[model samples]
Target chain A: MTRVVLVPGALALLPEYASQVDPVAELRAAALAAVRWLGPEAAVLGDTQGERVAAALMGAAGVRRGGTAAYLVVGNGSAKRSEKAPGHLDERSFGFDAALGDALVAGDLSGVDWSLADELWASVDGLRRASPLVSGSAAVDYADDPYGVQYWVMRWGS
Target chain B: MTLRLGRHEFDDDRTLMMAIVNRTPDSFYDKGATWAEDKAFDRVAQVVDEGAEMVDIGGIKAAPGEEIDEVEEKRRVVDFVARIRAAYPSLVISVDTWRASVGDAVCEAGADVLNDAWGGADPALVDVAAKHDVALICTHTGGAVPRTRPYRVEYDDVVRSAIDDTVAYAERALAAGVARESLVIDPAHDFGKNTFHSLEITRRLGEMVATGWPVLVSLSNKDFVGESLDLPVGERLTGTLAATAVCALAGARIYRVHEVVETRQVVDMVNTIVGRRLPARAIRGLQ
Candidate 1:
């Protein structure tokens, strides 16, 4: 059976980037839980910074890199969802994130527009690469944009 | 090292703000604002609301004045310490006195620390602190007599003298049965030293901190800052906070100040800059 877990590539999730008060506490909790469910070892796919966040979550879950049937993908939706977002406001961010989120939950990305995704400041490189491996309904553990940056934690099993 | 200030225990990384609550009518900064009991109580409430961890209640001003006897000093501060203790059980109450008799009375009334501003003028003050199991602030006054201003005081090396004298006083307090963690050293800026001497002490404060003993700096609106910046008492806050930041960078554990909120902010910011403290709730670019 193939298992897949998705978490946001939030730099705040890294131990070195921690603050006295956690800013992404809820997202971190959901991400950690979903990542832990991915089991002992999983191949990680993400950008450089996303890889750091994935490594931190794996370390926290006490999972080492080894052969496994699980795959962990670090990516996130639009960062320009609102005026306060890191990329500032983009009117096209909401629709882009909605379609992207739907495609991710449905484990289908053949219809996703990469150009629109880039215009909305979405981090979906890893998601695009891993979409071929995800072929079942995803259990969405979390979905929010508390800091004007959309984040999601989802898991798919087959 | 963990600090045991009477009934309270603070972790090694924790820095404390000891707010000044004067019971004297002639204190330089406030100038009789909290001289009355009710006013002093209100001051305590204000400082506690402002997030001060401790209060240093002084009966007599540092400057020489009409003689305030031990009985008078105890009358001014001991009962007030008891009253504050009853109201705020967790607030660390420190009595600023060099008199053993007043120290004993205030400790009996629930004072947690004896801040000997005169640098162990009363030889038995340490014994009183040890008996009550309270923390003692071992200060360096350059051997000047209590209540007397510095008059052309010169030292071979002011920093060395400060370190030597304060460490010796801390050792004496330890020998007198005071807990090692309960001892804090202060350079006593502007207490018995000229402006230049105080400035040197502030510059070389890391040497005192390097003694492996927790250092407390009482540099709030002192003459050293005023002379350094040519500002009077009310205008010396900026200079004082500047001095405070330097001391915080040097690893001072406690700040004795007239302005608790400002001093706390400066110390915390400096500590964060030095990587000794994490940002309060940072998510600026990491999000």
Candidate 2:
């Protein structure tokens, strides 16, 4: 089975921008655990900013990119889930994130509404890129949008 | 350079709050608020709860009043220091006295730093600090006697004079066997300094920080803050915190303050802006 891990592209996870208290502490812990379980080598899939978040998480988890069938996907849901959210409240964010999160946990990325994710500011390009091979069931270690930006830490495969 | 304040040790980059707990009946700010022993003890508990890393226990008011001799000053601070030590073992206990007898008595009672606000009035105070293996606050007072207000005390270059006098005092403390890391220099604002001198010191505090010795600032509700804003003691908190932000930017390590929470916020915010410290919990757009 192909090992796969999914984590949100939160800039707070990077050591350079860290605060004294971890704001994304639980999310970071879950991300690290899943990444560590991904073993020493895996293919990293994400956008430009997501790639940076992936690299930081990999370095922190002592995992690295190498030639392997396993995949580490970096992406997130909407930034407009509330009035205080970065993109402000967008009513479409609710239905969009609901469908997206369900698709991720079920490892069925083919149904992701790419155009709607872009409109809602959801980062799903990496998951979109891995859609063809994403077939196994996922175990969610984390799932929440504390800052109004939906984040999930899920692992797929044995 | 880790700070060694008697039994406690702090990291080099850490900025500390040294809350002032006056035991004087006529001190300008509190005006005998904590004159009684139990009231003073309550003040200690309050500052410690408010996150003050140190407490500067002063028995005598800064301005001239009734003369408090060695025996009287010792009587005022020695037991208070011992009681605070027994309660808060981790707290840095500093006794604000210019008398060697008071310093020795407080050190015997478990004091940490000797904050000589009179610019080394008692030369033997250094020896007392050395004898106790504690920290010493080397302050620059322009040769003013203890408890005397500044009267037309002019300086050719106030910052230069502050640097030279404070560094010289620090060296003197070093020669008297005080540990180099244990010595902190302060440009004692309003102590033998006019409003202009204090303002200049606050403006060019980086010169004092450039001397490589950790700087301690006692800008809490002082006359300079009052005179600058034309406000009374009760109205000088904003002014004091303004001066505090400047000193913190210039890399002052310890703050002797009356309002612990406000000063801590100002120092932490200023240090965070200057990159010396991190934000307590930043998660605005980075989430």
Q: Highest TM-score: which candidate?
A: 1
Mind sharing the TM-score for model 1? 0.99
Compose the digit string of candidate 2's lDDT tens values, residues A64-135: 788666889999899989998888999999999898888877889776777888788888888888787677
**Candidate 1 lDDT (Cα, 0 to 1):** 0.92
Mind giving the per-residue lDDT tens digits that candidate 1 earns over B193-287?
99999999999999999999999999999999999898998999999999999999999999998898899999999999999999888887776
Q: What is the lDDT of residue A121 in candidate 2?
A: 85
Assess candidate 2 and give its TM-score to the true structure. 0.96
- What shift in Å separates residue B60 of candidate 1 from its native position after superposition? 1.0
Q: In terms of DockQ, which candidate is strongest? A: 2
